[model samples]
Target: MNAVVFGAVLCAGVAAWVLCARDEAVRRARTLLVGPWGPPGPGCGVPGLRRLDVRVQALLEPFRVRFGWRLGRELLCLPAGLVLSVAAHSAVPAVLAAGAVPLVGRWLRGRESRALAEERALAAGALCSAVAGDLRAGLAPQGALAGALLREGWPGRPALADAALPLLAAARFGGDVPAALRTAARLDGAQGLAGVAACWQVAVDGGAGLADGLDRIAAALRSERDQREDLRTQLAAPRSTVLMLALLPLFGLVLGAGLGADPVGTLLRTPFGLGCLAAGGLLEWAGLAWTARIVRTAEAS
Candidate 1:
């Protein structure tokens, strides 16, 4: 009698689930057959789903601009969540790993920002050389700048052009060139423009030689770029060492498996093994963070 009652309850639950699923499918089909189709209406059934969707979109805006729409938050978190879930056979660690996706995105953005800075620095040097050459060839300041902008294969051209547009307009209208340049210097990824602005200001205000000033600035920028390259070469060994050390745990895991131990299963299934895994992950993260911080500080200097 007890077995019959249990079977009946199971069958009832399954039937209810099937009915709900069928109703949902029919509702979706009706929506599709009707006009103005997209996701179901905002008012349709699921509690908090709309709010959660809005929140996620809001969070993804910056990342979408940096890393594409498809490759933003979902790409970063989903694989990480899956890997953690598979490794641990648990949801809690997977959620925690997924939560770290933003940090990974932030780090990638930082690297991109630094690379952009370096590119802008190189482009500023090239611009200074080109403008100085044009000025020395008897062109006016406006013509020199315009000619430089026309040059092909100029690094950071898009960003520089965007920043220089206001300056170009001001120059054509006999307006304040220094003020426009200062504004350009305030733009994102245009920090190198500050040096150009300072050179322009001094030449205009003190009746100094703008061409000579630009030439000196170009030389100094090239020197700084060389120094930065040297610094990167010096830091390469240490960075490699840190990366190798981070991989040591993976090596150990592989070695343990080769020795006939069920290392992965032990780590995933046992509380003590989970504790060690978490601790090691934290240490590795800390080490990587410290290395990155040091490298960034050196680059800034």
Candidate 2:
């Protein structure tokens, strides 16, 4: 009777999932957020998969705006949890997975954000170096900035793209270049803009060597990037340890099954086993979350 009830529940969940796949409301929302076609995907040639991907992204756009990128992506766990519940023939593991999704996404999100920040820092250094080179090549300060900004893409530093319009207007139309740089500095990973602003101001006011100041700023940014990279490398061992500890229970289950213990059956079918499973899952989750919080706090500081 229990098995039959579980089967019925799983079937209902799957049917709902399928209905959602072709829902007009979902499609309408996707269209409203992402437009008629979708955002440009790679030339991967998988149109159907790519379309679905874009639609999810469209739906999650608000989540992304409201929260950050990490939670927005992690919110997919609501449906993913249902899928897991359906697959496992039990709800315990699915509930555990749903609860653990944030902890799961945290390390990955931190790594991605750190890498992007490092790239942005490197790009900032490159920008400063380019401007310095142009300055030494007989261009005025404004002309040097203009030449630097004209370089395509800005290379892994899309955040800097925000500054382009204001910087251009200032450079070309006698607006306050230093002020623009300072404003741009307010962006994450672009704090070097503040240094550039100070340099520009000193050069304009005190007749200091702008090229020399810019070269120093570029070198400092590069050094900061290297320091961050080294720090991440040092932290890798602890990250691996934490991740391994989190997966140890799965290893234990595999070992038990190899030793002829029906661990899976016990956990799924027995009340006491289910309680232990829930308790163990929560402990694992809390441990991961706590460690992740510490790591993030350290990184922030």
TM-score of each: 0.69, 0.72
lDDT agreement of model 1 with the native: 0.63
Q: Using alpha carbons, what is the TM-score of model 1?
A: 0.69
Residue-level lDDT of model 2, residues 122-187, one tens digit each, is: 767888999999988899889889778767344113334566668878998989999999997876
Question: Candidate 2: global Cα-lDDT?
Answer: 0.68
Error of 2 at 259 (Å): 4.0
- For model 1, how does the per-residue alpha-carbon lDDT over 21-115 read when each residue is reduced to its tens digit? 21222223333443223233223344554444445555666675687652232333554455446554666546765676677556545544565
Model 1 residue runs over 4 Å out of place are: 1-74, 152-158, 187-189
Off by over 4 Å in 2: 1-52, 59-72, 97-116, 155-157, 293-301
Worst 10 residues of 2 by lDDT: 18-27
Q: Which 10 successive residues of model 1 have the least lDDT summed?
A: 18-27
Using lDDT as the measure, which candidate wins? 2
